[model samples]
Target chain A: MSKAAIIPTQLSIRVPVLNWAVWPHDASVPEGPAHGFELQYIDAMTRRRLSNLTRMALHVAGVCVGKTPRVRTVFASRHGELHRTVDMLTSLAHAEPLSPTAFGLSVHNASAGIFSIARRDRSSATALAAGEDTFGYALLEAHVQLRSDPAAPVLVVYADEPLPQVYAARSCAGDRPHALAVLLSHEAVRDLTLTANRSTEAPSGGMQSLAFLPWLAQGESGSWTGHRHTWRWH
Target chain B: MSELKLQIKQLIVDALNLEDLRPEDIGDDQALFDDGLGLDSIDALELGVALRKKYLLKLDAGDASVRAAFRCVNTLAELVHARRTDSERTANE
Candidate 1:
């Protein structure tokens, strides 16, 4: 009624949600930003080096993987470990050597890799990024992985933060840094049936996962419009 | 000599993010790599940078002496102390 909504080709998908978790969950908490959420499973040496985003990601991931014996994970974040990458970049610009430890953990999938190490999980983890549809794509990836994966459940972890001040000149839609993990298994009840439609609209700046979380929790059904695809959960 | 060993232990703990460990927890003769501290190759690389920053200690990765020097906290301390005294002697000359 407001505008002419284009009808696009849609792909139907059915995936079950076994469990879910999020981090920095309390928005009303009056404390400063903290990444020191302790986990008994992770050693001090390993936990100390992680960024807040990675910590949040790991926290939600550990929660979702609660009692599951093993899982193959797909980690998605638009700006993965951006702060660490920025630090390493600054060192390079100043002609200083990058810290070997930082260099090792600066990858996009470092959180997934650390998850594997912490759990001592030999299961494979896939890390990916797609501008606005990272979470949506992760779901797609997980669905495919579940078909071939002999594992019980596939864990999908998504987290993102606002751009660092150093890169303030570049604009990003403001997003509260939060991490979400969803466990999907074929045996579980399929709560939401996903339908992805190809669209020509520009990407909705904010994270799709953030939009999907509330819809998944509260609404009977909802749809997310991205640059290339529109995903509906009902 | 013991003070230097303690100093080296502290450096290792701080540099490697081994916050769970204290300098006193590390024995002088404990192996640094697989057996005792359980450090791996990446840790050795990180320690090399820290050693250079603190004591100007630079050892070739390919050198046999470098491996021997890093065998334990005691060996690392000896190497760092030797490097410092040698640099000081050159500075005085």
Candidate 2:
């Protein structure tokens, strides 16, 4: 058996094949101000619609519900309910009295809670938010969880939108609404060889030393086809 | 009374961002929950805030009578009218 064939057939599949819902610069809500990417510019891009956190949960339920399988979910949103949060905070600061609707929608983990409600999925699921490092940390957490339960697959969905103007001043990455959902399992018939080391250079310093997860999630795979740090085949 | 109900319906549509919903869509006595407009708990809270700001009506969430006042668009408008009239009488007194 080849080395790839000889590897233990753990249930956690590595880099298990997945699909994406890409959102272009221009979409349905064109006149809704420059929230993120300018829709008119990225007309050529294919932005998936079943892509929002709410919709993603619906899709996950569609995939995992009623199946003879055990799967857990991890949802990552760098700016979870950010637009709603900012609007509520702005109103509160202005002494405008908080909107109960806004307060409920502004919860960071509302997406996760909604997912649970939709699927009635009482299984273990985690919601994570960690700024720019969100994707990396989420992936790491999913990896560790999969290692613990080799039989079940871990579904990792990363979702983020551009921060509002006030928040952008503090930390903004020009990222539009982008999301990637991957099913990770130890049953690695084929998977990426991931490795890393400490470096004096900044994390996003360059291609070789760069963190590819964010770029990859944003559909920059062409630029990182043969890069180092993280390796993915197929 | 009908005019007041219409205005209240319009306010509810706008305040709740019920896109494209017209005043007629909201029946004066229709239930605002799973049976009628499919509103949820959050919408109730938002409606309360909008009522307070737009009508200048003071409402405490802790008040028991609020449940009856918020029963429907007609009830809310009536409550507002009664409250305003009471305030006027007290001011005269």
Candidate 3:
């Protein structure tokens, strides 16, 4: 007997809290770059060790889960520290040794690893990168974790930085550095239903997480349609 | 403060990214590890690399003197001064 695959028709989640940080691309500021990241939540020495992408992720994650540890975490990024990887490659090409600190913190899951260390959290953490649908997959992973333990909340952080100039030709929607954190639980404050389907339409530009930011910021029920799926929050 | 001590202090601050700290703020004999400047192992490794690059000194990770030399800014300055003198003396020979 052949077994058929089962696809979930809908998924529900309750977001107890959410936080986001987005860099300003326009030349509104007179002097320094406008990253829009205060990051007062982290200490000075710890902050020094973080990259821009990790800093954004940790900032939002700290805000969403204040003084709360021992919760499962899912971090998603499309291009995780591409600039750092490029720098390492350039150094190799020149026969220069790589910086130990940079090499240690340049992985795709470095943000999640640093978050765990900073918070002293021992709970399970997962890092994901799935093309443009990374944010959706991360949320689904968080949902699975929430289902496993109803009492514990799962923190999902999505952060991405713009691709290096070498790969600028393939940039997508909202490619600027940004981070979003959502605290999900089984207790339903709001219901998010995700439906997957096939479509040939073009995907949204920049990071997929950007599309859900507006709906979350407004705190109103809405729907966002992606290239191959639709997310409804009500 | 001695010039070498001041230089080592500045190197520590810069290499470790010790924000809100200046060279003058660090005491010459103050402890740099836990209970003082609160630096950890990673900072130790980074400072060791910086010292090697700046002073052209060799550092042995397994050597006991390395930890003693890192005890304070005074000890670090003394280590750097000794290494420089040794290199100069060897060159003269």
TM-score of chain A of each: 0.87, 0.63, 0.81
What candidate 1 gets wrong by more than 4 Å, as runs, is A1-8, A28-38, A42-51, A117-124, A147-152, A198-204, A216-224, B1-7, B23-31, B72-74, B84-93
Which candidate has the highest TM-score of all?
1
Tens digit per residue, CA lDDT, model 1, B1-93: 888788889988897888678989999999999978888888898888778766766578898988899899888887877776446536756
Question: For every model shown, what is its TM-score relative to the native structure?
Answer: 0.78, 0.69, 0.76
DockQ, prediction 2: 0.35
Candidate that scores best on lDDT:
1
Share of the reference A-B contacts seen in candidate 1: 0.59
- Model 2 Cα lDDT, one tens digit per residue, A78-142: 77777777778788787777777557656666656665554456768898876555655566677
> A1-234, model 3: which lDDT tens digit per residue?
322234344555544443333333232333244256657766777788778788778777877776665778999898888888998898689765566677888998898887787777888999998777788788878878887887988888888877898887888754566778888865446556554444335544445677666666665555555565555554
CA RMSD, predictions in order: 5.0, 9.3, 5.0
All models: lDDT? 0.80, 0.57, 0.74
Candidate 1 residue B31 Cα shift, in angstroms, is 4.4
The superposed Cα distance between candidate 1 and the true structure at residue A8, in angstroms, equals 6.7
Q: In candidate 1, what are the lDDT values of residues A157-205, reduced to their tens digit? A: 9988877898777646556787888889976754557888876666666
Kindly provide the TM-score of model 2 when superposed on the true structure, using C-alpha atoms. Answer: 0.69
